[model samples]
Target: MDDLAVAIGLVLVIEGLLWALAPRMGRRLLEAASETPESSLRLAGTLAVAAGVLIVWIARG
Candidate 1:
């Protein structure tokens, strides 16, 4: 859908800006993320998805 495409595009733009403006910090953050536990990552990802859904639902309403 068009909305999904736009959401993906926005995510890319934001991520690209962070990498372009602060590649060093981005790399370090990734490195730290890599060392993080799978459980923690899963929990974080789940929370992010829930939050995103809530945001979209409210916005649409």
Candidate 2:
């Protein structure tokens, strides 16, 4: 779908910029993400979902 394409493109652009600007930090972040505990990762996912819901609610108002 067009929405999925646009989302993928945006993600690629953002990731490219981060890779170019701070390669080490980006690597560290990626490694940290992989090493993060499942419980903490789940918490992070929940927080992200809550934030997304809040953003949508605010934007729709």
Candidate 3:
């Protein structure tokens, strides 16, 4: 749980910096991410699950 929290916090920090430095880019990314196809979204979700599992395994070890 602590590891997951840290990972999420890091993502938040990075995203915040991107928004601060390139707000337009962030908005474009948000729009693109939202308009992504369902199939692409599913693939991205699968990749995220795999990556999260790997991170948890590595951190817990």
Q: Assess every candidate by TM-score.
A: 0.94, 0.66, 0.67
Candidate 3 lDDT tens digits, 3-41: 669889998998799989999998999899989998999
Off by over 4 Å in 2: 1-13
lDDT of 2 at 47: 100
Ordered from best to worst lDDT, the candidate numbers read: 1, 3, 2
Listed per candidate, the RMSD to the true structure in angstroms reads 0.7, 2.5, 2.1
What C-alpha lDDT, on a 0 to 100 scale, does residue 15 get in candidate 3? 79
Identify the candidate with maximal TM-score.
Answer: 1
For model 3, where is the 10-residue window of minimal lDDT?
Answer: 52-61
TM-score winner, 2 or 3: 3
Report the lDDT of model 3 for residue 18: 94
Question: What are the per-residue Cα lDDT tens digits for candidate 1 across 1-61?
Answer: 9999999999999999998999999999999999999999999999999999999999998
What is the lDDT, from 0 to 100, of the residue 37 in candidate 1?
Answer: 100
Error of 2 at 58 (Å): 0.2
Q: What is the C-alpha local distance difference test score of each model?
A: 0.97, 0.89, 0.91
Please report the candidate that would top lDDT against the real structure: 1
